[model samples]
Target: MEGVFDLERVATFVAGYQSVMSLESAHLADTARRLWWKRMTDFWQLEFHYDRNDDSCDELYIADEALLHWWTERLDVVERTFAGSAQVPNSP
Candidate 1:
């Protein structure tokens, strides 16, 4: 489901998933790295917009590109969050 980025929601979702099956926190950290790498290496969105002469996915491309920057900047915090080592604000 697509929605605004919320770290707390992400943590909750991960915790929920862990309830069903065991997942190593280290795995989450590794997955974050892999995702970042994939984002860094991918240009499909740009290809679609520029090469394919399509604008339908422009907004998505922009959002994802921005997200890549955001994620890169907060990579450490993200890894910590995934590993349950960072403190997330308590939900009200």
Candidate 2:
């Protein structure tokens, strides 16, 4: 998650492809899949600072939007689940 938002191909991937099952839409609000996107975004191009373990390094061609969308999916799923859940009866 360091130095992200610089630029990546994920946005183009999502915009070009609209398939929900595909990687493009796998992290969309509908599917609620984030494990993949998170993995990608969290990746850093440590090639330059691998030895030093510097976090202020550039991302490995990651998209900040991709991460944002991916994270939002979790909230979206949670909200939907709670919104549709039936009220639980209180047992005194």
Candidate 3:
């Protein structure tokens, strides 16, 4: 069966988003640095789980506070980056 989203791809997207935004300001750069580690931890902690009944590994059944906050912050950076780019491709 296929998953709804690819965790690795999500992680890569988040990293790329952070890298692009880090160029704007020192504070944003720090946030992006922290976010990279947070994303890695949150991905493994919240995205991977074990099924008790089946005794097998599985994707998470639900999202949690940490993951929610992580994604929200990630989206915020991505939005800001997109909004700021007037003509440039904004590649990072």
Candidate 4:
């Protein structure tokens, strides 16, 4: 996995968000799963770089795809970290 995105950063970000915004652990976990699924099913990055001949988002696409794999391999840890970081009350 690339160093572009990591669990610690995500956890820290979620914790920071919780300081100002109220978030539910289940909601966050669900959203993360959905996003991962979307990426798993999408070819937009390839389309963009090949079909559309645009390379502007290449780096982002690469990073996101890498993160997708990273997250998939650590789904449980991701959920737990997100839940803990968000400090959501009584999340299952």
Tens digits of per-residue lDDT, candidate 4, 5-90, equal: 45676778888898899998888887877777887899887889999999887888777777777667767777766764433222
Candidate 4: minimum summed lDDT over ten consecutive residues — where? 83-92
TM-score per prediction, in order, is: 0.80, 0.22, 0.28, 0.67
Arrange candidates, best TM-score first: 1, 4, 3, 2
lDDT of 4: 0.71
Give the candidate number with the greatest lDDT: 1
Give the higher-lDDT candidate: 1 or 4.
1
What are the Cα lDDT values of the candidates?
0.75, 0.41, 0.44, 0.71
Model 1 Cα RMSD, 1 decimal: 3.3
Q: Give the per-residue lDDT of model 1 (tens digit) for 1-92.
A: 23224678777778788789888889898988898899789988789888999878877876787777767777877776776556765432
Q: Show pairs that collide, candidate 4.
A: none
- Distance from true position, residue 10, model 1, in Å? 0.5
For model 2, residues 1-92, the per-residue Cα lDDT tens digits are 54322122333344456444344232353343344345545644555467566656555345544555544544543323222322222221
List the candidate 3 regions with Cα displacement exceeding 4 Å: 1-24, 44-48, 51-92
17-83, model 3: which lDDT tens digit per residue? 7677654544554564566557545534333343234423333423434454544555545433333
